[model samples]
Target: MLAQRAQLPDGRWHFQHGPMDIVIGAHGSPASVDAAHAAAWQRFTGILDELVQELVALRRPVQGDCPVLGPIARRMWQACQPFQRSFITPMAAVAGAVAQELVACYERSGVTRAWINNGGDIALHLEPSQSVRIGLYADIARLGLDEIRDGILTDGQFDVSSVLPVRGVATSGWRGRSFSLGIADSVTVLARTASEADAAATVIANAVDLDDERILRRPACELKDDTDLGYLLVTVDVPPLEPDRVQQALRAGLKRAQTLRAAGLIWSAALVCQNQIVTTGDPATKKLENRRAHQQLGSVFA
Candidate 1:
C-alpha cells in the first residue's frame, strides 16, 4: 500500500496514520490549527483506496485520454508527463503528490503559514518570518531509481529547509525507502513546491550513476504486488565501486543536476558521497545547519 499519513496537534499533539506520514503544527488561533487538522484529515481519508484505484488504471501505458479521478493521481500523472515517453509511471512521484495536496488543504484555508510534511517530502506555506528545519537523510536515490545510472551515491544524514518561496524537499538514493537507479545513498533537492521538488529529485536521482551491468536490478512489479512501475526494473543492490568509478558516478548525477538547475527546474541541491560534499547553485531559501556550531556549543546549551 502507499504511505500517506497525517496528524494535528494542540499541546504538542503528535499524529500519525496511513501512507501520509506528517508531523505538522501551526502558530495562530486554535481555530486555525483545528481547521488545518480537519483539512488534513479530509484530504487523508480514503487516499490509499483512491491511489490503489489509480494504480490499477496506470498498470499499462496511457492508451488514450485517461480520466483524472484522483487528486494525487492527477498530480502524479502531471509530474511524469514531461518524461512520460521516457518510461515513467505516476506512482514514482506519489509521495510528493500527496505532500503537495495535503499542503494545499491548509493553503485553501486562511492559514498565515503552514506546513504539510509527508514523510520527508514537505509542502509549506510560510507567512513572513517563518521557516522549517528539514532533516536530510543519508541517501539521495530515495527520490527514485535511476535506471540509466550504473551505481549508487550517498551522504551523511543532515538537515535543510525549503522556506518561504521554497516549499518542496525530496531525496533519492538506492538506500532509501524507495528503490534507486544509482547506488547513491541519498540525493536531496528543494524547490518551489513539494511536487516540483519531488519530480526534480526523481530526475536527478536517475542521473546519479553510470549505466553498467555490475549493479543488480529487478523489475518494480517483482518487488511488490501493486507497484506503479509495472515491469520497470527498480534499483535493488550494488557491488563495490572503485575510487574512479565513484567519481564518475557522482559526476554523472551532478552534470544532470546542472542542466536541471539551469533550466530552472530546481533552486538548490546538496550532493554527497562517502565523505565528499558538492553543493551546486544556491541552496534556496535556507542553507545547511552548521555542525561545528553544535559541537562548539556547550552541552548545557541547546
Candidate 2:
C-alpha cells in the first residue's frame, strides 16, 4: 500500500510512495494554494506505479534508442541524455524529475511561488517580484554543535530571487541517500530544472574523486540490492587527507563543474570536501557564504 498523504504541522504537504518522498509548499491566494495541493495530490498517486513499470529500463545506462514510456520516466531519460557518453542512468535524475513533475502540477494553479522538494532535489516556481531563501550546507559533518543539537544547519542560505535564471537545486555526496563514487562531503548544483540539477550533481560529485588508499569503497549493489550502478564502486568512508590532497580533489571536481557551466548545463555549483568549499558558475552564487554569518540558521533541505 502507498503511504498516506499528510499535512504537517509546518503546513507542508507530505507524500510518500515506496522510495519516493516529497514535500510541497506554495504561497498564493488561499484558494489557489488549495487547488494546487489538490492537483499535486491527484497527480502523485500513480507516479510510483508508472515508474515501477519501467524500472528495468530506467536502471540501465542511457544509450541510443533507449525506451522509456512514462512521462516522468521520459523526463528522467531526457535529463540524463546529455551525459549519455558518460556512465549515467535515468535513475540519476529520478528525484529531480519527480520534483519537477509536481511543480508542474502546481504551476497551472497560478501560485505566486511554489516549490516541490523530492528528497532534496527541488523544483521551484517564482513569479515576478518574488523570491525565496534556501539553505545550503557545505559539509553536513562540519555543522556546529548547536546545529547538530537542533538537528539542522541554519547557516547557509541563498536568496533565489526572481531575476535569477535558477529554478532547480540538488545536492549529492558520499553521505547522502544515493551512492556516490567520489569523496566529496557534499556537492550542490543549481540549474534550469530539478532534473538537470540532479544529473549535474551526480556527475560533478562523481568527478570529485582521488586515488587515495584512505578512501573506502564497495560495489553499489552490495549496499543496495537494486542500485542502478550495478558493480560500480561507491564510496563508503573517507579518512583524513592532507590539505594539498584535499585541494587536488576539489580542483578536479571544480574543473568538471566549470565545464558543465560553460556547456549551459548548470547555473552554478558548490563543491565541498573536508570543510573546504569551491564554487563554479555565476559570481552571485558565492553569496551563499555570507548567509553563514547568522547564528539562527537552520538545516539545509538536503
Candidate 3:
C-alpha cells in the first residue's frame, strides 16, 4: 500500500507507510505550519523505499566506511559510529533518523516548537524561549490505548527547553518492538539528535542485565530470521527477581548510560526494570516531574 496520512483531532498529523507510523505536531503561524506539514509529507513518501534499497548494509554491524547512500541511512550509520566498539548496526538508529529528517521541515521561521514522534523515538525543534513537556512511561507492556487516546498517565515528566541543547528522545527495552539483551522494562535517553538518542537507548537497554536463572532468552534469528542480531541471544521473559538482583542490573545499565553521557553521546537517561528506576542525573536538580499513570510508546525500527 501507499503512504497515508490523516489529521488528528488535536491538529497533529499522523503519517503511516509500512512500518513507519509518525505523529507530527508544530506550533507556528498557519502558513508555516501548513507548509512544513506539506514538506514533511513529501519527504516521508520516499523514505521507506530508500531504506529498503540498502537494507543489507543497514543490517550489518557498524565498521569501516559507510555502506548506505541514502541521507537518512548515512545519518543512522554516523549516529552508531561512536558505539562501533560494540556490536551496533545502523538499524539501531533508523526510527530516530527518520523522525529527525521530518522534524527538519519544521525548523524554518515561524515554527516556535515542533516534534516528530516515530513510535517512541522523537525529534524536536524549539526556537528561542520555547519548550515542551514530555511524559514518560516506565513500562511499555502496560501502555494501554486509553492512556494514549487521553493524556498519558505519565510515570514521570520532564521539560525540554530551547536552551537545554536537547532535541531528541528515545526509549528501548526487552519488551519493546526490537530485541534487547537486557531485562529493563524501559530505558529512555535524551540527546542532541534523535539518531544519537535512539542508538544510545538501545545500547543502554542492552546493558541492563545480570545472570538470572529465571530469565528466558532465545537467539534473535530464532524470533526473526532476518534480524540484524543474528545468533545473539535476546531476552524473551524475565521473572520477578530479588531486590538486590534488580538493583545490580539497574546499576550496570546506569554505568553504561553515564559513560555515554561523559562521551557526549547522550545528555541524560533513565532506566527502569521491575518497578525500580535509575537515572543519570539527579531528578531534583534536573526538575524532572514524577507523576502517576503517564504512558509512553515502545521503541521500534523505522
Best by lDDT: 3
lDDT of 3 by residue, 1-302 (tens): 89999998989999999999999989989999999999999999999999999999999999999988999999999999999998999999999999999999998998889999998899999999998877776676776888777855567777788888799999999888889999988888899999999999999999999998889999999999889999999999998899899989989999999999898888998888887777887542144323422213442211
Local accuracy of candidate 1 as per-residue lDDT tens digits, 1-302: 54344343334233355555566655556687678867777767667778867566655443346556877788777665665555556666777787788767666445666666556666776665556554444533343557225432222233233333577777666666666666565567777767777777777777777777888889877898766566767778767667687667778878877777788777776654543345564634224323211100000000
Error of 3 at 216 (Å): 0.7
Candidate order by decreasing lDDT: 3, 2, 1
Is candidate 2 or 3 superior in TM-score? 3
Question: Clashing pairs in model 2?
Answer: 153-298, 153-299, 154-297, 154-298
lDDT of 1 at 172: 63
Best by TM-score: 3
User: TM-scores of the models, in the given order?
Assistant: 0.76, 0.92, 0.94
RMSD of 3: 3.0
Candidate 3 has which clashing residue pairs, if any?
Answer: 152-294, 153-293, 153-294, 154-293, 154-294
Question: Which should have the higher TM-score, number 1 or number 2?
Answer: 2
Local accuracy of candidate 2 as per-residue lDDT tens digits, 1-302: 87569998867899998888888888888898999899899889989889999999999999997599889999999999999998999999999999998898777545889889887889999988878777765555556788666777554667777788888998888878899989887788889999999999999999998998889999999999989999999999999889889889989999999999999999998787776777884665587554432211122432
lDDT of 2 at 101: 89
